[model samples]
Target chain A: MSATESVITTQKRSIWAGGMSPLKVTYGKLMMWFFLLSDAFTFSALLITYGLIRYSYPGYEGNPADFVFAPDKWWPIPEKVFEAVPFLHGVSAPLVFVGIMTFILIMSSVTMVLAVEAGHRMDRAAVEKWMLWTVLGGIAFLSCQAWEWSHFIHGTHEGPMVAEGTTFFGANLLQNQYGPPPFADLFFFITGFHGTHVLSGVILNIIIFYNVVVGLYDKRGHYEMVEKVGLYWHFVDLVWVFVFTFYYLI
Target chain B: MTMASEESKTIQVTPPDKAKIRKIWMTALFLGVVTAVEFVIAFTMGASAFRTSLFVGLTLVKAFYIVSEFMHLKYEMKVLIWSILIPTIFIVWLLLALLIEGEAIFMVKF
Candidate 1:
């Protein structure tokens, strides 16, 4: 043992020596993972901030069944505020629209994973088909968000009075008919941030889809790019699960 | 140039596995069912600590499926899994601290 140790000591070895993929993943994928970790922190900070602000507000102490929407209430019930559905005026459908939106996102995520799976097999035709579906799904989800946002911004038909002679018609940065100003602001910020992610994910998917159609990945002999983008897409879906829980459900 | 070629060589494109595809759809179905359950609870049940906790638990279940199955993190190396999961604990801690502090502020101000 001593002779071998002396021989090994004579030859220098550095732990910092490069040329090894320790995680058994490509450099691009590893970087994406780290970027996602940092992005996770950013989102966590936003959500935790929302939780803190929500906690600071005094919620309704009455029975949930007897609850009604009042302008003076500091913390408005989510179901009451988000009751209206598209094309169904004055309908008391709580969480239904958001549920549809969630379903769309999850379906898109499924299509995305299918695309990645198709990529794994180097099936160009299948990849194109699934990627197209995934892209369409993303566009559909974004369209749903736009409709929801417009609906939220325009607000209900009642246009309840917020103050003396000041009828609140809709929500904005300064004021809203629903709860507090922060509620509207956080809704816009968090959902807007998430919407931006979905938008970017769609654009990225388009680019990758274009590349796939153009036979770029085929020429390159690999489709790891799709897998990387799939990671980001899945992360977006993951974030929505929590947002649905926090903003809509809780 | 050699490194690029060597890397490509190590990356093999295998035929798609039917079992794996079935697993993906099954996970998706699980996510959809959990979400539907959340919707049902949102309507059927009223707001309370228990209801909130139930929703949160179901959300974690959905998150687990998305991360593990969709993201394929479950098949990754152990070190990679730990590296991602460990940092998330601090986020939970932040939530706890700020919630407590927020409640205190409300108690004092209101």
Candidate 2:
């Protein structure tokens, strides 16, 4: 083939056309993607370990009564474990709080996307407003998580004593009212780790919101900062989806 | 996009378009619906391997939706997307190895 023909043949075919970021994404956004990828593995490892240990047990087998913590193991039903809403004391509402928490995270993610879109259009007021909502959502999620932890730690308000057979109630680093002790450990580790991420996301978002207020991005002429922060916020939401599924649902 | 508007040396303030905001709202609605379905399924379904698989599959769908829509991975370069995704094959490997090996260890012990 002629030199020109070879050059033409070897050139990137439509796919790899853009220089570094063929899709035209920003550097910070690309780095955020990498960071999320690494974080995904960390979560996956923890989750897989949870699966291993959980399956090793005999499982609840439907009823917690027939279940035991011995050779034939039984992990407590998550629904039975987390069955409390804020003020509705003594009510048996399983997964209600978690459902609300899921909605909150998703709405925050929406606000985050809108903020990024506003950044794209250089709408400072819109960016700030949407970002503020996003920050509130994060705080709300963190607060919900705190209440959950405390509730778990405090156990039931006025239930039977702990000496009721092999079964335990509530949770801690030690034994949990849940069937298997490891189950509580996994719950604490996975959700606690996720809560820490949510905490960091809140802090990062506040800084970005402050930046938007001070016209920092406005001066820079672009709101890529909002987009970068949005990526992290969305990732936190994404991980929560999996956590919600495996921990609570399954 | 340039930081400063050509007309103004300062930042140009363009208003957020309604159509785009509506689309974002719809995405949020879709995510919420999916989660609601998962919640309903959790209550209705009993513990079985099939139910567990269903939950895993649904979780994956939700995960992908968040990554694509919220994280904007769908709008990213294919190379960049693959660079982020293909490596996840190791997670599959890690899971299989850990689970199988873990089971083997459990069997040996108990």
Candidate 3:
């Protein structure tokens, strides 16, 4: 071949020549990935803000064993504040409820993967089964959060006195029995944001499940739709891992 | 029959792989165990720099599994993986900058 002709042929064969996907995915899937990447940035920004606000406060400097929820401490110990579980009032069960919530999210994520796998095999019945389980898990996580939020709102009976004549009760945007205002504020913002994502994920999974039952994807000759939604569901679970680490574990 | 039914008839469906499903469940079990360990540390150990680092490290590990295995990012093309992961580098820089600023503010106030 002539030199110019060879160059032209190479140019036509380039991955970016617009005939094939360089990313090896459909246009819709690629868009979903980009959307998730942007969402990750948003979540990271919120988390970074939480870290900054948290660091700006004067945290407790005393012995960790001697830590207690007091007005003077600008950063109340997390375990001490988040010790309540459902139906077990006044019991100090540190990290148990959140642990369950984490497991639920992770389990749901696993089911989502299974659904995607089933979709790949064109197993409509299997996809429906796993998708149903995933939706239920999402709902379970949301219910757990609602209970946790209510418990936080209903502060402990022995809440510390914030002022000489004022005893701080539950938490709000303005005030909280917790260490500082930003503490409760960040908790609400971060977890509430994550919860919103989970809620939407549940809704999307339901729609996908309905479509699966109707044999829409089966008729369409591909279950790529389930795979796309699976990506979103897994991203939700991934974000929760970070949230659980920062908000609860740390 | 309708065109849709005719199209569905021509589509090839792979039989389900038992091993893949088992692997997915295994990953779920691993995540559960790691979370359980985190709880154990929370209750047993006091707040310290070391403990915080451990928690962050474990969290990253869990995130890796979710993104790679469950999200199927590992199976994607390298160009796609890099495109998604590279932007997160800036998030690390943002975190470091804001944390230093926050600590400085605390020092000034206290």
Candidate 4:
């Protein structure tokens, strides 16, 4: 490396090694990875705890695997229970909508990656376009989640014969159409926590999107901000993979 | 140093290479396909013991991609990898043991 380049690299290393960087990454990129690692542990703890609880309460009913339209002694299957949309009555899209949401988030993550790539290329227009797409993706995912939560809360009632200790939204801690307690409680707690993460991720994307538009990172010279956010965005997507497997699939 | 000036100075640094950028995108595509396959397996297969095993296996595949590629742990230092992995293994073992014990307690109570 040239003298100036070598000096810059050494200075960067020392600054990061000593800590006290606002971005936490002397490279800005490495700090994002560290943050993502800690975040992974958080999601892992929640998911593994969900698994423990799920296994402990086996055969309670409302099997996510084999769901139906109406509630029975068996738990409403996950696919069946979460198969409707808000205000779109009589449309049965079991897991289809959530699947779409998943793809959307994944695609947004792809766009974010591309933006990071563009940042690396110093292609200002490309970065701007992809960042905009990424932000849109986040918003779309959030909207879908909102619809899902609403559908879950305002569940459809079939009969007047109320099953004591049974809830409209399948088995929950408060009560369920099937299964024991802790099932619903765990479901709410785990999925709710993940939803909150998605919400924060959306907010962060918006902030980054704004920054990108204003040419904050472009003027500064490095696209590490994009890289950092890209890590976080991917991490969110990563958490969803586990959640989909444990909560819905298995 | 003042925060504003420091921030400005940091922003002045240039971006990385095009090859690294392309690598990230290619890795993401791979992750996407793996995830799709996971969903397909989960949906099509029956819940037999073997199927469950397969599902777990696929889940692991997806997890590997997310950790190694998306999270870039694969490129990280060996010490970093071991530090994370070892603790994760211990935690998983502890969780399983506790779950088994917890189940036993539940059976006794209920």
Candidate 5:
């Protein structure tokens, strides 16, 4: 080859190498991590706000252990108020359902990790399978959360005593049911924000799943998409860790 | 034509070993056991100071494993690790400061 031809060939080779190189990381995954980091701040703000509200309003009428919703007074005990379904009626399963939701999210995170691993191996089948599981897990968690929301919204209220936008757990802020006005407002705001995240995650996972099935990522010869979604999924799981702690355990 | 052949060669490589798969499963199982312990402690133990401390401690343990293993931060560069850790520390500090201030405001208002 002529000297000029060799130089051009080398340049072509370098460009080819760059284009063909398997991406160990992708811009999408990096951006997802950044998104999760910002989301962490949002949740931290909400939870800290909750703590402040709870701490300042100490010695309200009801016991934190056995709290009941009274229009005049009472802070709804996290345990008493959150007892929910799939554990059957008359059984004290407060926080149990939320606990299950936590587990589902975490397990799905595990599946996401597996998908990333599969991506590393270039194992298309494994990626598809695990991504499917992760998607299903996200859906299951959203369903449980939706049920929890409905239960909160339509809580037991009797005639004459019943008030608009008021539920059995506590008094509504926009309207009064149980304890103070801010209680319901904070509950809706915090949990609503988290639910919105779960919704977006579900949508994201579905997109990733579609990408896997259609072999978009396989053609690109990188599974960084899976890794990025894994990061996001894990972040969602981590936020729940704090939620389970401060909101439920503490 | 040459580039196409090179790409084909790379694509045809075999999968990783079963040992790696086994290791991944073991790590996942360990995470599961840790989660079960967390559940037990949260449910069975009374809401005492000690229980609270223990719960927080176990949660940190679980968080560490999830971040290091599942998120593959262990094999990553120190710069990456510090990048995540430093921000997280600042966030916690911010949360504490804000929480205290918020409580004071609430006390004044209520």
Candidate 6:
């Protein structure tokens, strides 16, 4: 081997400099991946905090089966607090509406995947079509969340009222009709944080949609942008899965 | 600028795979089914410690599936996967610390 070649091969190197990216991924993808990981930490902290606080509170006293919608205690059941549906008020359907919302978010994630697939095929029309549908799905989910929030604000007909020494009725940062104060606070905080993410994702999708219509990707001859957005959209969907379980189901 | 007028930015393009399309569909269906099962279990099952653990386990399954399939993490190299996942171990530490602290708070006051 040539002396220069031998020296080059044998040179000691710092680990980070030796290989910038062993995965051979683009900078954009790497950043997005790390970003999602950090985001997951914040969510993990919040959910774990919920668990911590939940176990500390003295829960309702009665047979669990008979109290599906009775949420007036130190540690009320989530289904009891969130059983109301918009316009179908008084007709109790435990977790039914939230289930629909979950499916909606899942459907949007599916469309986002389709859009990324279209982008891979260099089909501009298909990309635009699927992206638009994805945006619509985001809006639908936000609307559902808004309805849910309003329903929560209106207070349940069966609430024990805020004046009661044992149960605090109505919701604020300080108190809620549901069980302990932390229950409502965490619900509002976690779901509100998630709702903000959905809003931001929708806004991002709109920007992407506009770019698609303006032929930005057409000129560039690739739609890795769509794929990046797909990553983000799917992350939102994934987060919602956790939120639904920890906040509603559990 | 000395760039040629006829030249344009180039990128590698691969043809779409029909199998991938099928895979996406199956993933969505699987996630949907899992969610539906979670709902069923929630309603039918009594509130117990076992029920909570079951829901949490199912949730993790769904989360892993979405990350692998929809986020395409399955296609990534091992190094990248490790980088993203290993940091999450710290979260377990955080949970342990906080839960103990929270229990202490309960013991002290509420």
Top DockQ hit: 3
Per-candidate DockQ values are 0.51, 0.57, 0.76, 0.27, 0.35, 0.51
Lowest summed-lDDT stretch of 10 residues in model 3 chain A?
A158-167
lDDT of 4 by residue, A1-250 (tens): 4998888777645533654653323555655665666777777777777666555554434444444433233333466556665566777766777777777877887787788777777666677898889878888888887777656645556412235553455344576543345556766787788878878877887787788776677667766777777778877887887787777766
Question: In model 5, what lDDT does residue A51 have?
Answer: 75
Per-residue lDDT of B1 in model 4:
35
Model 1 interface CAPRI class: medium
Off by over 4 Å in 1: A1-16, A163-165, B1-15
Q: How well does candidate 3 score on lDDT at residue A177?
A: 79
Colliding pairs, model 3:
none
Computed on alpha carbons, the lDDT of every model, listed in order, comes to: 0.88, 0.82, 0.88, 0.68, 0.72, 0.84
Query: What is candidate 6's lDDT per residue for B1-110, written digit by digit as tens?
Result: 22322222343345668898999999999999999999899989887889988998999999999999999998898899899889989988987888787788778765
Model 2 lDDT tens row, A1-250? 5999999989867755655556577777778888988999999988888878866665555464443333224566778778889999999889999999999999899999988998898888889999999999999999999999989877786443344365455667777665567877898899999999999999999999999887788677789989888888998998899889888887
DockQ, candidate 4, vs. native dimer: 0.27
Docking class of 6: medium
Output the lDDT of residue B37, model 2.
Answer: 83
Instruction: Give the C-alpha lDDT of model 6.
Output: 0.84
Residue A112 alpha-carbon offset, candidate 5, angstroms? 0.9
Question: How does model 3 score by TM-score?
Answer: 0.93
Q: Residue A232 of candidate 1: its Cα lDDT?
A: 99
Model 6, position B94, has a per-residue lDDT of 88
Better of 3 and 6 by DockQ: 3
Give the TM-score of each candidate: 0.91, 0.87, 0.93, 0.76, 0.80, 0.88
Query: Residue by residue across A105-219, what tens digits does model 6's lDDT show?
Result: 9999999999999888877778899999999999999999998987776677776555435554467777666656777788888999999999999999999989888767867
TM-score of structure candidate 4: 0.76
Off by over 4 Å in 5: A1-27, A59-66, A70-74, A157-178, B1-10, B102-110
Candidate 1 Cα deviation (angstroms), residue A23: 0.7
